[model samples]
Target: MRRVPRWALLSSGCAPVVLTGGWVVAGRLEGGSYDPATQTISVLAADGAAGAWVMTAALVALGLCHLVTAWALRPAALPGRVALGCGGVAALVVALFPAPSSGGSLQHGSVAAVGFALLAVWPVLAFDPDGRAPWGLRRVPCFAATAVMGAGAVWFLIEIQGHGAIGAAERFVTFVQSVWPFMVVASCVRHKRPAESRL
Candidate 1:
């Protein structure tokens, strides 16, 4: 297996922190006008929102982090890496096409859906065929990770349709997607072969 660069950990680890922190800070900036439980994070970045810039910046940073992580994750299959990188690009596009403050934007919604799908399926696509693959890249775990993300996506959609906790659902799924790359990097580092110990 090709070694995963040590710096991959930094990029992957920062993903979740940036995502969670972005929402929390942005929500606060929005004051009592925003109900996190009912509003999606995109609303925080929508036009005229109090913390639009902050959320937009966070989305950009998050996208860059994913792109960096994908580049450094040499141990994963090429298709998986490509998918991850594309997801990052999707994030960037979503930031560029922020939703309207008062209503939904088709472009923003489409880009976000694509990003979610890519992130959700990247785990399974990343599965290493080798029997000695790292725990995070093994077939079973990869499938499980994809399955969990898929289920989270479904829950988020249901919440969106029912006027439930859309923000909470989105946060849960996004956090899981962000943390997954970190977990994979950790597994790679922990199970590094002696020949690849330089990192």
Candidate 2:
């Protein structure tokens, strides 16, 4: 029942904006040849890319935002909060270990995968068994959201294996992941209660 702090709201709300804006700006800077449908965001931040700094800065900011949001999200369960924080850490690690322009980096891919899994699973871990849970934190919605993210991950993996729309799939999944925290915060704010209740 703890109300989400104003800072949490602001941080959560900015996540999607920063992430999407970063990609847009990076893509434009990289020129028309950069196909968002195929090329992944990491490419923009890869070594020797025109917008590498921009994308890297954005990613670092995004990771910090997630960390702040996780810290402020007191209504969620402890395990969920821990997972969310760890996901944020993974994001930071991803930024630290950027992939090469021509090839991949095992460390980067592993960290990205960890980040994705943590973000996707945090919702279910945060779900409250009690009926008083906020709408967004309810089991049905949380599970559905997690499922969609998982499916997106699968699609991304499939695209990676072939010359498919990896960029589009990644953008969709990451966007969803970025925006979900805002939804949960809003729900907490809306259903603000007097006591700290399980969520």
Candidate 3:
């Protein structure tokens, strides 16, 4: 098994924090005007929004973090790493093409959809063919993770169509996506420690 460097934890771990913190702070900046239950995170990054800059910066950081994590995750399959990296790139593009203040932007929605799909599927793609992989990267676990993320995405889409808790749905899915990398990295590190000690 290839060793996963300890520093991968930092990059993967920061993803959820940056995303959650960005939305929280941005929501606060929007003050009474923003309803997180009904509005999406992209709204916070939209043009003329009070905390657009903060949200944009957070998104950019998230993208970089994913890119770094993908590069460091040597144990995962190459296709999985590429998908994760592409997801990161999608995030950067979403940031660059911020949503419109009053309505949806085709470019923004398309990029975000692609990012979500990539993030959701990357876990299964990362599954180890052999049975010796870490817990998080194992076939069953990876499949479970992908299933949950896919369900979350469905919920998000349903919410969007119904004009329901769009923000809540988005946050739930994105949070799962952001934290999954950390779980995989942690498992790899823990699995490595035992082997190292034996050696």
Across 1-199, the per-residue lDDT of candidate 2 in tens digits comes to: 6767877889899989889999999999999879999999999889888998889988888888889999998888878888888888887888898989888899888999999999999999988887787887888988998999999999999999997999999999999999998899888888845364444
- Give the Cα error of residue 141 in candidate 1, in Å: 1.4
* lDDT for position 69 in model 3: 95
Structural similarity to truth (TM-score) of each candidate: 0.96, 0.95, 0.97
Task: Look at candidate 3 and tell me the lDDT of residue 185.
Answer: 92
Residue-level lDDT of model 1, residues 149-198, one tens digit each, is 99999999999889999988998899999999999998987876756666
lDDT of 3 by residue, 16-126 (tens): 999999999999998999999899999999999999999999999899999999999999998889999899999999999999989779999999999999999999899
Candidate 1 wrong stretches, greater than 4 Å:
194-199
Clashing pairs in 1: none
RMSD to truth, every model: 2.0, 2.8, 1.3
Worst 10 residues of 3 by lDDT: 188-197
lDDT of each: 0.92, 0.88, 0.93
Clashing pairs in 3: none
User: How accurate locally is residue 139 in candidate 2, as Cα lDDT from 0 to 100?
Assistant: 89
Better of 1 and 3 by lDDT: 3
